[model samples]
Structures are given as structure tokens and as C-alpha cells.
Target: MEEEKISELKDKLEREKALLEEELSTVGERDIQNPDDWVAAPAEMDTSESDPSEQADAYEAYGENVGILHNLEIRYKNVRSALTRMEEGTYGVCSVCGELIEKERLEANPAADTCVAHKDEEV
Candidate 1:
């Protein structure tokens, strides 16, 4: 990639990283024991609501937040890894095949670490 294109992608990745962190903060918190891990924020239950149905609803919402947090955490880690690769001067190389990742693929997903041919392969 040209220096100009790399700079543009770096800016995009940084923007995405910030957005992911913001979204993650809303539903989760960084684990104190593991700085890289994010745990879903537990839903606050209203003690005034003694109804069993209300309690169930609160638990359900917590479950949904857990799911959302899990997904956001995955994307956040991928974006961080891509940024590290960029710093290492290997951002555009496929990890599996050691080939240049397709420009269109990179455009579609700036965090991609593999070419289209090996995109489905486990890293």
C-alpha cells in the first residue's frame, strides 16, 4: 500500500477503534484483572419491584447485554490487532498465505488479516 493510502486506512481504523470502545463502554466494563478483557455490565434490578415477572425481565435484559458485549469485544480485539500490524508494517499481508490482501477486501474490512482465498480459514 502506498504511504498515502496507508495513512488513510490508519485514520479509519483509529476512528473505528474509538467508536468500538465507546459502544463497548455503554454495555460493558474493562476487567480490572485483565486489561484486554471486557465484561458485560450487570443490569440493575429495582428492589422496589417485588414482582417475579419484573425480575425475570431484568435478567433477560442482562442476557441480551452480555451477547452484545461479547460481539463488540471480538471486533475491538480485531481492530486492535490490525493497528498493531500496521505499526509492524505487515497490515496488508495475509497471515495464512503470506500474500497481499485484496484491496477491496481491506476496503470492506480494514481489520482483515487474510486474503479472500483464505478468509474462511481459521487463524
Candidate 2:
């Protein structure tokens, strides 16, 4: 990719990375032991005086947060990985085929590490 286009994409990726981190913080917190990992936000409920039904609802919400966090964490990691690749001088290369990734694909997903041909395949 041209340096100018790469710069544009880099800007886009940085914006996305910040947005992902913001969203991740809303539904989860970074694990102190593993900075790269995120855990679901704990429900702030005082069970001592709360009704049984309220406690159950809190648990349900926690479960939903866990699911949402899992998805957000995946995207966050992908964005971070893309940024790392840019620094390593391999930003636009397909991980599986070692070919240049399509521009349109990169435009659609700045964090993409594989070409359309390898979209369904794992790297």
C-alpha cells in the first residue's frame, strides 16, 4: 500500500482502537493479572438486603455482560494486533497466503489480516 493510504488507515485503526477500549470499559474491566484480558463488570448489588428476585436479575445481567465483553474483547484484540503488524512492517499482508490484502477489504475492516480469499479460513 502507498504510504499515504497506509497513514490514513493507520489513523482509522487508531480511532477504532480507542473506541473499542471505551466500549470495553463500559461492559468489562481489564484483568489486573493479564492486562490484555477483560472480565465482565461485576454487578453492584448488596445481597444482604436485596430481594431474591433482584439478586437473580443481577446475575442475569452479569451473564449478558460476559457475552458482550467476549465479543468486544475479540475485536479489541484484533485491532491491537493490526496496530502491532503495522509497526512490524506487515500491515497489509494476508496472514495465510502471504499476499497483499485487497484495498477494499482493508477499507471495510482496517484490522483485517487476511484477504477475501482467506476470509473464512483461520490464519
Candidate 3:
């Protein structure tokens, strides 16, 4: 990749990582032992006037936040791995077939490490 495009993508990735961290903080907290790991905020579980329906709502919210946190964590891992690959001078190369990935694919997803052909397959 050209240095200029790499620079632009680096900036975008950094900004995105920052935004992800900020969003994670709102509904989650990083694990003390593993900074890369995040956990959803504990469920509120208010008394809710001893109403079962109200308790169910709180549980639902908790489940939603947990799902969100899981997705963010996965994205965070992918982005981090991409950054590491860039440092290793292997960014934009298909991990499966060892071919240069399409520029359009990289533009769409900087974390992509494989070509369109290998995308749905395991590395």
C-alpha cells in the first residue's frame, strides 16, 4: 500500500478505535486483568415495585448491553489485529492464499486480511 493511503487509514483506524473505547465505556468496563477484554455493566435489577414485568425489562436491557459488548469486543480484536499486521508489513495480504487483497475490500474494511474469495472461509 502507498504510504499516503496507509497514513489515511491509520488515522481512520485510530479514530475508530478511540470511538469504540468511548462507546464501550458507556455500557461496559475493561477487565482489570486483561485490558483488551470488556464486560457489560451489571444489570440494574431495581426493586421495580416488586413487579415481575419490570424486572424482566431490566434483564432484557442487560442482555442487549451484553450483546453489544460482545460485538464491540470482536471488532476491537479485529482492528487490533489489523494494526499489528500493518506493523508487520503484512496488511492487505490475504491470510488464506497469500495474495494481495483488493484495495476496495481494504477500503471497505481495513481489518480485512483476506480477499473476497477467502472471506467466508477460515484463515
List model 1 lDDT by residue over 1-24, tens digit each. 998888888999999999998998
Per-residue lDDT of candidate 3, residues 1-123 (tens digit)? 898888777777778888899888877999999998899997788774788988889888889999999888888878888888889888888999999899898889888888999999733
How many residue pairs clash in all the candidates, one count each? Answer: 0, 0, 0
**Estimated TM-score per prediction?**
0.94, 0.95, 0.89
Clashing pairs in 3: none
Candidate 1, which segments miss by more than 4 Å at Cα? none
**Global Cα lDDT for candidate 3:** 0.85
Between candidates 2 and 3, the one scoring higher on TM-score is: 2
Pairs that clash in candidate 1: none
Please report how far candidate 1 places residue 65 from its true position, in Å: 0.7
Off by over 4 Å in 2: none
What 10-residue stretch in candidate 1 is worst by lDDT?
Answer: 114-123
Tens-digit lDDT string for candidate 2 (57-80): 889999999999999988988989
Point out where model 3 deviates above 4 Å.
Answer: 47-49
